[model samples]
Target: MSDLRATFERDGFLVIPDFASSEACEELRDAALRLVEETDLESLGSTFDAGGQRHGHDPWFLGSGGEVRAFLEPERDGDRLRVNKLGHALHDRVPLFDRFSRDPRLAALVAELGLAAPLLLQSMVIFKHPRVGGAVPAHQDATYLSTDPSTVLGLWFALEDATVDNGCLELLPGGHRLGLRSRYRRDGDRTWTDTLSDEPWPSDGWRAIEARTGTLVAFHGLLPHRSRANRSSRPRCAYTLHVIDGEAEYEDDNWLQRPPTMPLRGFV
Candidate 1:
């Protein structure tokens, strides 16, 4: 997708309309809700927050109810949840990941940016709860991913309507062109933190993307972006698919690195 590349370079992000069908969103949403219902909040792993909220239970690890929800709502820094609970199944299934992983359009984009082959490592869903605008402080994804600049791509697929009224994503256009910045700790209840830019540049072409269910937004990891609190009646939910050059090493620590209990192909 040269279009994807162009938008990424110019706006630091590209929103692909109707990239997923409404039926797909419904299916995933139902699955997530069911998992939440069948799960026990206390039995799940404990991750303590700064305010002592103890919001550590990942929806993915609670028996057959699964761990996808918690994986999506990852605990803040210093939490013991190592591997992403949803990585194994998503790595095995999810055609969306497969197509992007194998597509020449995406592959070439990675190469053009000087990234390795394979083009992706971790893929999972991210769901932001209503009235729950936790900290996703302004920072580059590179600070957390630790990959070569411009070599990584972050794809976010909205399964529900995402809008400014409900914490839709806000971005600074062309921010990726700037090299990496130092990391910083998050202030207040924000979950992530990073070194702030001395002369922070607001969006010369700032855009507040409000898309219907099934819209896909792809951007460089270094783009400075954040979403407001979800004041709307609905949860601002989206799926994040992290793709790096296949040739690139897995530099960050996330659930993709977890030791599988069983191999799908039985290689392990």
Candidate 2:
């Protein structure tokens, strides 16, 4: 654990192999598919393109932080609806997701990473569908979920094998030391990104992290990371959770905000 902590402190990211069993991964995948099947596609018209120029301003997108909402991919096959992701409040709304999110192993991981009072802020299941899975632009987690002192930690779990050909995560080692580059915040009904630093992310040191099923990759809030478009026939599915230190003051202007009825929770 000490070694793991040291490595994480140095590189700003750590990849743990087989953190969860194959059965657990399969269960989560099945649950996500069930949620998609139960959703009424005809009622949903919002197409979410993560890499779009006008990202994060949509009312539907901005309002999803406290509810379980499904976002669709830009492309569709005739009447067939392709979902890009299911997000924000799955940990609180869905039984399976809630159990997984509050698992003791995860709580231990958070403690080992040095967060004394960790608050789970957001959760998502990203379905990188075959042929249409869009590319995610390089950005930091703190941009979307900012805290005063910046104590956000991202936990990405691979539900299926993440390969280089299937849009696996690519990260710049030790890039968190470069500091926060920008912030995505909400102003009344509108949302915009504020640039805090002009420093360019290095191109050469980026490493593609190809993970096997059930692998958990934890990264710092300021770590620079992105994924390419999935051109393969296989789908790269992954579950993610973002946690912030309760000790830090959460920025009110941050894009993802929960209503007063729903307070943030920690893994018990």
Candidate 3:
């Protein structure tokens, strides 16, 4: 555990193989597929483009922080309903997701990583569907989920095999030490990004993380990471949970805000 902590501190990210059983991973994938089938595609008009210039301020997107909702991919096959992701509150709203998020193993992992009083802030199911899955722009998690002293940690679990050909995560090693590059915040009805640094990502040294099913990759808030578009026939499904130190001040202006009725939770 000490070695793992040291490695995480040094690289700003750590990958644990077979963190969850294959059966558990399949269960989560089945749940995500069920969510897509249960959703009313006719009523959902929002198309989520992660790399789009616009900071997502649409009511459907902004309001999803406290609810479970599905967003569509920007491009779609003829008559096919392509959902990009189901996000923001699955852990709080869905029973299976809730159990997975609050698992004892995860709680102990957070403790081992030295996050005292960790609060689970947000969760998402990313469906990098074949062909139309959009590329995610390189960005820091702290830019959107900001907290004082910046202690956000991201846990990404691969429900399906994540390969280089299927949009696996690509990260810049030790990039978290470079500090936050920007802040994404909302001002009343408007949302914008405040640039903190103009530093560019290095042209080299990027590492592609091809993970097997049930593998868990944990990364720092300031770590720079992104995934390419999935051009293969396979789908890259992942469940992600973001946690922050409860001792830190969560900024009110952060784009993702839960209503007073729903408070942040921790793995118990």
| Candidate 2 lDDT trough over 10 residues, lowest sum | 49-58
Cα lDDT tens digits for candidate 2, 181-220: 9888888778887899887778799999999999999999
**What order do you get sorting by lDDT, best first?**
3, 2, 1
Candidate 2 accuracy as TM-score: 0.96
Q: How many residue pairs clash (N, CA or C atoms closer than 3 angstroms) in each of the candidate models, in the order given?
A: 21, 0, 0
Model 1 gets an lDDT of 0.55
Q: List the global CA lDDT of all models.
A: 0.55, 0.90, 0.91
Candidate 3: misplaced stretches above 4 Å?
53-55
**Please, what are the lDDT tens digits per residue for candidate 3 over residues 37-85?**
9999878888887886453768888898899889998788677879989
Model 2 regions more than 4 Å off: 53-55, 77-79
Tell me model 2's lDDT, rounded to 2 decimals.
0.90
Per-residue lDDT of model 1, residues 54-159, tens digit only: 3313323322111133332334223422211233235335444454335465455456544545445455555566554343546666654554433557767787
lDDT score at residue 219, model 1, on the 0-100 scale = 78
* Candidate maximizing TM-score: 3
